[model samples]
Target: MKKKLAATAIGAAMVLSMGTGVLAGANLQEIKAYLNGSITVKYNGSPVQLQDEQGAVVLPITYDGNTYLPVRSIAKTLNVAVNYDGATNTVLLGEQAEGVALAKDFKNSSYHTKDPNLTTYGGKDYKEVYFDNAKSSRSSSFMLYPKGKYQKLVLQVAATGNDIESFYVQDSKKDIKLKTTTIAIQDGLKTIEVDIAGVEELFVHADIKEDGGMFVPLTTSYFK
Candidate 1:
C-alpha cells in the first residue's frame, strides 16, 4: 500500500535490509498481483515478508509443493540485482550490486547478555541479538561500515522510552541521538531510530543496561 520494493546497492558483501515501507504507495494493479500467498520465503537462509503497495504484509505462494516468491522482494532480500524485460517476459537476477555494503557486528558489554531464545515475534523465532540491562557496564558497541555518503539509518530497538535515552550514534566526532520508534521490519513489532546522514563508519552504543531488570533485542538494522 504505502511501501514499494527498494534495493541497497552493496558490493561484495551482500546486505538485504527490508524492514518497513520507505515509499508512500505503490501501483494499485501491481499490489494485487503480489498478495497471492500465505507462506514465508527464505532467501540465503533469512526469512522475508512480501508486502503490497499499501504496506499490508503478503506472503509467498506455494503451488504443487513449490514455493513462489515475489521477484522484486526476493532479489532485494538476497542482494541480487534484478532486471526485467517486459516484452520478452524475461527477468535477470544478479548477485550483489553497486557500492560496498556494511554488515552488523556487535561487542557485548559486561552486563549485555545474549540469548538465542530471547527473540520471538508473531510466533516466529528471530535469532536477533538481545542485550540485557547493564548496571556497571557501558553500552555495547555496534559497528557499521558504510561505503559512501548517505542519510538516515533505521534500526530495530526494543526498549521503553526511558531506556532509549541511553542510546546514541557515535559518528566521527559527533554523538547523535536516535529518536522515536517506528514500525518493525518483522510483521508486527516496534523499533528505535538512528540518524546516519553522511556517515561512513560509526558506532551505535546503548548504555541502558545500568538500569537493570530489563532487556532489549535488536533485529536486522540496515541503512538505505
Candidate 2:
C-alpha cells in the first residue's frame, strides 16, 4: 500500500485551520515508541498494550521535525473517533457517531469541483473515460497490451459528493478481470495504476455510487 503521509498531513492541516484545539503536549519518545511497536499505549490511563495488524507497534511518526501518530488508529485504540477536514486541515478526536456528523459537515461545506478534462497520462487523452452523475452510466473501451509491452496502467480520478468504491477492467476472450477496492475521494486529484501482462481489448468500468451526488472524471494511460 502507498504511504499516505502527504494526504494525511494535508487532512491534519485542514483540521487545525478549522480552529480545532491541539493537544498541548505529548512526549516525543513515548509517541515514537508507541508507533514503532516498542511500546503499547493504553487509554483510560491503563497499561494494556496494543499492536498493529502485524502485531508490531504502529510506530509513531516524525515528519519535518514534528511528531505524529495515526490519528484514526490512536483515536480508535483510545475509544475515540477521528474526524479530518481536507479543506481546512483540521482533525477532531471524539466518539465515532459524532465524527460522522463532523465529516458530513466538512463535506457539505468544503465540497467543490474543478474541470477534470485537462488530466492526462503518458500523453494519452484521459478525459475519454470521465463521467459524472449527469451521465450516470457509461462505458469506456480500451486496449491493454501484454505486461512486457507496457510498464503500467494509470487511472486518474477526481470526484466530490461521492466516493469511488470499485473499478473493473475485463478482457472477455482471455477471461482477465481486475477490480479496485473502495477508495475515499478527497478534495483534489487522485491517481491509481496497475501492472498489465499484455495487450488486449479491455472494458473498463469505474464505479462512483458511494455518495451518489458526485461526479468522477477518469483518465487511462500506459507508461513506458
User: Please, what is the whole-model Cα lDDT of each candidate in the order they appear?
Assistant: 0.44, 0.40
TM-score of 2: 0.33
Q: What C-alpha lDDT, on a 0 to 100 scale, does residue 53 get in candidate 2? A: 30
RMSD of each: 17.9, 17.3
Cα-lDDT of candidate 2: 0.40
Best by the TM-score measure: 1
Best by lDDT: 1
lDDT, candidate 1, 65-151, per-residue tens: 444555555544444445443444445444223322222444444433345555554465545555454445444555565422334
